[model samples]
Target: MLDTAQYRMAEGDTLPALLERYASAAKATEEAVAALPDLDVGVPLPRTPWSPPEPEVWSARRVLLHLIRETAQHAGHADLVRETLDGANTTAQR
Candidate 1:
């Protein structure tokens, strides 16, 4: 895992710059995934302190599913925050 502290934005960094960086990274990831010939291909997992004790390999499909779930979780959290600030139901059906 990366040391996130090292990648923290500088004090002078603007919101637009930060958003643009995230957008670029997301596009790159999408392109890379699109190029993959087989989503079932598995790779040895990097053993970090947070990793399971047992050895593991993760297929590309599993990784993508995890990413999707995590993104949804974050979006939910953001919606909660937004609702707290203003009584708006962003996810409610129109």
Candidate 2:
């Protein structure tokens, strides 16, 4: 894990810079996942060297499922926020 302190953004940070950072990280993550061997998908994740240590690590498949679920959850939140700002209806009114 990275030192969280260094990644913190100041209050004056620009939106484009923050978005560029997100894009870079996302692209790197995608590339790393793509480079992994196909046979390792079901293997257990490596143990971390943390003090308390991780209770349970997830397999690649579980990680992928979690990513999918999280993305869906965030998308829902974004939709609500957008609707609130624009008064645009995302769903059919009953």
Candidate 3:
């Protein structure tokens, strides 16, 4: 389980600051992924409550694909929220 306490927002946190941090982290991840010499390298998955019963290994390629999938999912969710707030359909044809 994640330590929610450690991830909680600070008292003065603002949306802009949070977005800036997210952008920086995303850029760093992109750079790191690009610099990886081999995508076939694998690592043992961490054992967690939600993880599979048997140990499994994930390759760098798999991890990258997972990250891309997750990011796209989150972006879609964010778009939904934005559309709800502004009554603008982001995906609608112009």
Candidate 4:
């Protein structure tokens, strides 16, 4: 019953810029998946094929899972980096 898209922030369309694009895409994937109803999880993806040997890219299901896993990884990195700068991992403390 719902669909979603998001803005992409980029540097200048190069390797370093690809970082922002990846982060943008990951964020967009997250938002789109979250907008779906539970029943939508196994349904076909809207923009891309859900099964692929064609592009060798992840499927929608895999994208969703990766978003979750990578969110945790990025959060951990943020926490660790923050700690290195100021001595804290706030989520761990709270």
Q: Poorest 10 consecutive residues of model 2 by lDDT?
A: 43-52
Model 4 reaches what TM-score against the true structure?
0.41
Better of 1 and 2 by lDDT: 1
Scored by lDDT, model 2 comes in at: 0.74
Q: Can you list the residue pairs that collide in candidate 2?
A: none
Could you give candidate 3's per-residue lDDT for residues 1-94 as a string of tens digits?
A: 6445545788999999998999999999789778888899886776665677798999989988998899899899999999889998846595
Count of backbone clashes for each model?
0, 0, 0, 0
Model 4: residues with Cα > 4 Å off, grouped in runs: 1-31, 34-54, 91-94
For 1-94, candidate 4 gives per-residue lDDT tens digits of 2233233344445776777877897788668778877623554434433434444444567756765898899888888888999965566553
Per-model RMSD to reference = 3.2, 4.4, 2.9, 9.5
Model 3 misplacement above 4 A: 6-10, 44-49, 52-56, 91-94
When sorted by TM-score, best at the front, the candidate numbers are 1, 3, 2, 4
- lDDT for each candidate structure: 0.83, 0.74, 0.84, 0.63
Clashing pairs in 1: none
Per-residue lDDT tens digits for candidate 1, residues 12-77, read: 899999989889989997997898889998866766656788989999899889889998998999
Better of 2 and 3 by lDDT: 3
The residue-by-residue lDDT of candidate 2 on 3-94, one tens digit each, is 55544688888999988987998898688788878624664554444425545656676777777799899889999999999999767888
